[model samples]
Target chain A: MLGPHAPVATPEQLAAAREAREAYRGGLVAPTSGVAHGLVQANLIAVPRDWAFETLLFAQRNPKSCPVLEVVEPSADGRVEPRLAPGADLRTDIPAYRVWRDGELVEEVADATAAWAEQPLVAFLIGCSFTFEAGLADAGIPIRHQELGTNVPMYRTARQCEPAGRLSGELVVSMRPIPADRVADAVAISGRFPAVHGAPVHIGDPGSLGIADLGAPDFGDAPEVREGEVPVFWACGVTPQAAIMASRPPFAITHAPGHMMVLDVPDAAYAA
Target chain B: MLGPHAPVATPEQLAAAREAREAYRGGLVAPTSGVAHGLVQANLIAVPRDWAFETLLFAQRNPKSCPVLEVVEPSADGRVEPRLAPGADLRTDIPAYRVWRDGELVEEVADATAAWAEQPLVAFLIGCSFTFEAGLADAGIPIRHQELGTNVPMYRTARQCEPAGRLSGELVVSMRPIPADRVADAVAISGRFPAVHGAPVHIGDPGSLGIADLGAPDFGDAPEVREGEVPVFWACGVTPQAAIMASRPPFAITHAPGHMMVLDVPDAAYAA
Candidate 1:
């Protein structure tokens, strides 16, 4: 999960990710990421059409974290357009998936073809932290997840996202340790990309966000806070997914954490 | 209808207008310009609660003209709260009102109180053109309606508003002929206040908006195209009203054209 890739490995890795997904359809590679490169990855949220507008409104109100990329319309015949990727079935495109029943994820899935239906459900594509980490590195900012060779650290905060209809919940944010001098630069760099989680919500104190300890993140790996550094927090896209879990409609689907749907749009488009 | 107060009226005239509305619950003081200086005036629309979200989304999608100032929650006792003024009822608040049935104007009433009910419905307060025209004069931009003592010219355009759900229509704009040299200054002046129709949508060429003649507008009076002056169009708040007329819900209520609910908030708040 951690290591710099060869210059050619970027493309090679993306190819391998696609190949893995293909083999995933045939039962090969069991996880995504560590494989894709140059391709824009996305968080996936699938819900019935009846609740599409409320969910969409939730994304709009909590834009910093839940910046939507594309909304794939389910075809009249109950199939996600092959546009997510050619010859790809949403039910089987990723290495892993999670199925939620009445708001609680009941089972992890390898494929959901049997679950695909004629119901007018919608699929939403959201930008992810991985997309921003690429930009941070380009700006000479260090990312903690890459350093630890583990998942990025995320926590539920005291901050609540703007509520819309039935969609409401506390915000979840991801943290990265930043050098004291580079904090401003990191903020300025990320602020330019409003489509992604633009800028830091909190810069210095984890307690200010009701986060008890830096050592205990609600999700992913714990980060090392250096002597002269501070932990910076950015609104995490997972906030909406969490809200969906709480609002639990009859049926909903999301990518299993790290696995993402690579898109035709480039990361550059995510920039403001 | 045309008098010295046509451009500027005293508070007494506005009070009389309000009193007249309370008397028989009716009055029509054409071109509400200068009528209620400090009182909140509102564009009115009444529709069954079932279609509330579509209309709200329509207004949100077309913010330039339909800048909602407030929303009246659906009542359980058939009474609207936060009434625009004392003894002011949504049923009979405004001086003049138009009623639409199945997308057609069925009646023009002096009061609509008879239709009042605990039925679910939502109301919104949109920014009015009067708010911006006042700011323009403060900035030294003499508006034509004030000088010529006439209503502002409003026209329907070829440009379509972004559609939401059941709402869709071409934009309607108010045209003001400004001194040619002052167009840029006028834009910079008005652009600072986006809440009140913001900047002009087009600077010249009425034909571009699908208007066949400048002498005749779909609404309001035409202006003389003075020498060295150009027609400047601003998004009118009427666009939402027009959309409502097109997609007429079974039941809806709106303020008469010029009779508005004067809000406690000042016009200056509309300034960006």
Candidate 2:
């Protein structure tokens, strides 16, 4: 309903997001990779009104993994538009939406309005690593998963996120194996963007985070570990979803894996 | 009763704080200057347990001025210190304490143990600019107020802080006039330390922030504004103090102006 659908493989970022948004409005379900080049993409979560404050505090305390972009305060008034995407509807902007009841996946819908119809929901747009990944790539650092055309490997680590009231769970991290030489460059580049998940939380040994097996990821596709490459783990936005599942919030909504909300902010806005 | 008294201006930071703490514990009323020469000193606020969350969120949202060092959750069990200072009692560490009730300063006491005695109090240690000031001085930037031997001039501005539930008020800023040539260095030096007030919220044109008179200040001693030197305003820790007064919380405790809790953390821990 916004742009066009099924963007060309190498479409420009905004054009691609607009096209993808258009496709999504027309009931198209697809991942938003390479859609909006140089723009910040975000993970979306919608939860009951009562759980909003605790969730906000949880993200605030553990900002690396769950940097809040826009929090639409929960209200009985319903469906307040966020300023992140102008003229875009939160319920219909993303390619696909997942509805979870009592933390279990109940349905996948193109539009969330139907399931979220009467419920008082607070929507949170969380910073995604896609923007920083663009920075890493711009710096000439290789993104192993991108190179392999697979989802970035994510793991549920032993590192517990700071509990905010009732919301508490283990931190989740997405691993990006970098050539040994580019590790410092990667950290320095990403460290500047605290609004997004900044810098690698853990580098080299996965064992330090209690990540038992690198090949066996809890979420997303595992990437090939190259010679001379070390696995760097950055806090992942999916952390809240895992926390929600563990905390069991009764009802919730999230973007399908890899299906993010494309914001108007350029990825470079987050660069130092 | 921890350290000593009147550290010979150049005593080691830890030794200096120890001396100052000893003097305060011995009921010697004095300002805590040159006490912890290179250590981070904090602004302390102890409020009721029910108001702790809102206060934490207020500080989280208005971080530049209210960068939290550690929040000791209010428990009926009494003062539980953070690792900021081991064996340092929150009740007796600072030189002086201010007690507020129903938004009015009720007493300025030698010790808060009596006023904050038995109630469940949540103590918040907020970052102070002294750490960043150390960095600026390191870069050869002149600290006008420090040189003049006075409290930094603070002003209440028209800028509204992001409110958390009941805690909301106008922003308060501390002004330091930087020589035109060194303003950039001052910003660069301070920006690295976000834990303390980082960078100038307003650099030039005091009118832009709705301050009509440079000579008149809301709090602290007024400094002579030099010609050709730009007045740089940084968010002040006094902001939460003003907010507490405005919000009229049942009871609150704060460090008497310039009398801060000398933390064990060296000033460099805050450096970027």
Candidate 3:
């Protein structure tokens, strides 16, 4: 529910976040970065109650793919009494959402209220890179997307996640090419934080992870690999989404790729 | 079972493991640590199929207390289809066992084949410190118990675990007093390995964890705190067991504390 012609600046994004919760009522901001400085952003997933246990099991089985920040399932009154933000409506917090039916993309909507009923829809919010990006920047590790003003490139890898009941898919990774000498530094910096995606799952050699070409990606934009750099891969939060979509649940809702739910919790809370 | 005169030496301990498994045909080398050099060790919990999910959730919610290494509830036999060391019998792997009924201790025996019924009894092999103790020694971190020739001191702290379905209790911690200068390095080293109870849960003052006196522990021997040392605490495996005991399931089986099942998997498998 981002307003047409609303500025896309970080302040605008923050304003959009407030407006979505305050003025627009369940509206979403365009992009979640810049808007909520130093706050934690999360990738959201809403599934039917019947699949809650399976999804949670899948997350547990494949933690690197889905580092769950929190799992919420509201009672009939639509309030997640204990483990949720005040008035935090899962249906409207994020800027955008994707609806899946039987493993197919059915709709991209702002609100999932119509699709949600008394069936006890479970909501899971996963950790995002927005938190780590701030740390990397402070440590002088430049994030390519911010430099190019584009989205980070994501790839489907041969890495297979530990399967758990109807959730199975190839691992997905986001590529951030770092200078060869700085790879150790990057690992040391990111390694300190595991609540968000921890140290690189794969340090070098894209082919070892079944990535064929650096010029192409299954999602997001292509990376600009420098001469002295190697493509470092970190487990992406999308792996669970891919697994759910592949499993083709009867009903599932996820935040649109890259558009996350901004929470009041600080980024430091996510650090293990 | 160990002989009354069993040396209690590492090799003698391993021979005991082999004998226990040999008693059961196609059995394991009696659950593997102290049997083979650098073999992985595990704590076992066997629950009826009906209670599998709840127990697994308990482990998941209280990870430090019940750090699961692997789950083996084979679909066919309703027994733990041993993986790291197949043909191992959960019912008789460890030298000693405990059976709980409706949240109370029912019996302490050497084997539970009599308790085994046709239905599946899900088994969880959780990681034990015996794995990390080797690493700690390899890193030259002096373990007090090794010197004192006694069991590690364990205390039930005021720290409560995140609860899940009929499972929740105050965290039980194993204390290891370390020199003040080595505390930070010890944390760094242990932090690298999350599977083995990760890093120290409480670093400085034990009082913060509601531990009033170091000389007295709820379980195990009292610590002899040396000068220039601070008592460091690691999340103990007893945490989940305590919670399960409080929850009082209809029936449960656990390896007698300290008598772990040795797996064929190497200790390195525990590292991140």
Candidate 4:
């Protein structure tokens, strides 16, 4: 967690984040794990103007899994821009895009400008766990997925999220194996940053959350749980996507899994 | 703050809360400060359906002052019920209601059923600062208003809340005087319950927040500041009303200041 006097974002970090977005806008597609160091990265989800209320209510109801960083309402002229990253087009700044029609993945594209233009889109920028990874590392707690150089393992639990209007789905959680004794430290550190997925939702026993196997996940890469380590689960940003899949909005757009939009704000800006 | 194992609400507390609601429903009009001890109390704001989206977005944007506990959407056939207290009629269960027309307070009534029938209303149950006073008292921090048996002082500040579509206003804050040495302790205690206007927005020197005089507040009672005490201000639940006053919608309803809905849930349910 950042101290009270920490600067939100340094001038150098701001320039680097903008450069990364420019590169993505030019057709670079990849996971954005370490793209813009010290800056915040967000999960993207955009829906039609009519469905925007339910979507916003869903995030407000399930804040643990879907902490909204910013909401960019569709403009009168059909223009959209996230305040988190001013001047960066929401349609093309992300590394990759996933277009959904009737809750199914219709296409994966390098740019979503055409899909976004189909109708007025209300875009939501949601907080990603990547914003709090540095805090855990600073506390001497290891992040298993970062060490293995893979996407964090995620699973869809039996737990049903609070239904909001026409949107409802199971909770999706990302897992990280922590040394047995350091689990408390990990919870304490991450709990300080509620804006970014906060504390672990489940500390052990995946079966309690209805996950059958540790090596097999519903989304992302598999985990490597070693001896003396316990699997800890934090609410994942994929929850909103899970809701989109279940609720089946007629038209929707989101970032391809693990591909995020880098924001100009610093990670400390999200620290509680 | 409650421990992990604390029960949400005792059976006795639930019964007391229900009885209090029944009394209010039977035309007993009064403030709900100590009516049902250990139960949560909330500020009420109901708006027409057309303005619900903008109102919800405003709350989402200004979470500190408008931490929404529950949103009771109008049901088919125009029925309204708040899930916070089952079997409770939102329009008639509250002790008092304020009828607003074009940003003006037209009347204060004991029951709002007649006014509610005029339009489909979406009611918002917002967190109240009374929810955290116990925590402060438990930490040995004095709450000035409680000692003097007066309403907590509230003020409209120079700080502008992040605006949403068609809804905007200056932030309103509730003030409580704390001993100079215990200011930090008060902050740490209240900060635990983010759902209920967490932490102080300003510590001392009310002029910094554009208040010309501390005693003459925009709302609520005049505070009694004693020797060795500093005034601490927190985001007040009345902020949404401030927005209703600033951005006058066609129609609106709210609980009269200091008269709140006593919910069946325990105060611990809101603890972070």
TM-score of chain B of each: 0.82, 0.90, 0.82, 0.93
Per-residue C-alpha lDDT of model 2 across residues A1-272, encoded as one tens digit per residue? 01122122234555666776777878888666556777788989888867776776677677779887776643354555666566677888888888998878888899988877757787888888877888888889988777777777789999888787778899899899999999999999889787788888889999989998999998778679989999999888989988987788889999876678887767656554
lDDT of each residue in B107-154, candidate 1, tens digit only? 777766665553555666666676666667777787887687787778
| lDDT, candidate 4, B245-266, per-residue tens | 9999999999987789988788
List candidate 3 stretches off by more than 4 Å.
Answer: A1-25, A33-35, A81-87, A147-149, A177-187, A203-216, A221-231, B1-39, B48-57, B82-87, B113-118, B136-151, B176-192, B203-232
The residue ranges of model 2 lying beyond 4 angstroms of the native Cα positions read A1-27, A45-54, A89-92, A95-124, A147-149, A162-167, A226-229, A245-257, B1-12, B18-34, B46-53, B100-106, B114-122, B226-228, B246-251
Candidate 2 root-mean-square deviation in Å: 6.2
lDDT of each: 0.67, 0.78, 0.70, 0.86
- Candidate 3 is scored at a TM of 0.79
lDDT tens digits, residues B22-132, model 2?
Answer: 788677765554456678888899898778767876876677788877766534556656566766778876878899998899999888777777577878888887777
**Ten residues in a row with the worst lDDT in model 1 chain A?**
A1-10
What's the C-alpha lDDT at position B159 in model 3?
Answer: 75
Which CAPRI quality tier does the interface of model 1 achieve?
incorrect
lDDT tens digits by residue: candidate 4, A1-272: 12245457788988998999999999998777766776889999999978888888888888889888888875666567777777888888999999999999999999998999898888888888877777788777888777777877889999899989899999999898999999999898888888889999899999999999989998778989999999999998889999999999999999987789999888878777
* Per-residue error (Å), model 3, residue B212: 7.0
Q: Cα deviation in Å at residue A82, candidate 4?
A: 2.2
Higher-DockQ candidate among 3 and 4?
4
How high is the lDDT of residue B213 in model 3? 89
TM-score: the better of candidates 1 and 2: 2
Q: What's the TM-score of chain A alone for every prediction?
A: 0.84, 0.89, 0.85, 0.93
| Model 2 docking grade | incorrect
Candidate 2 fnat reads 0.00
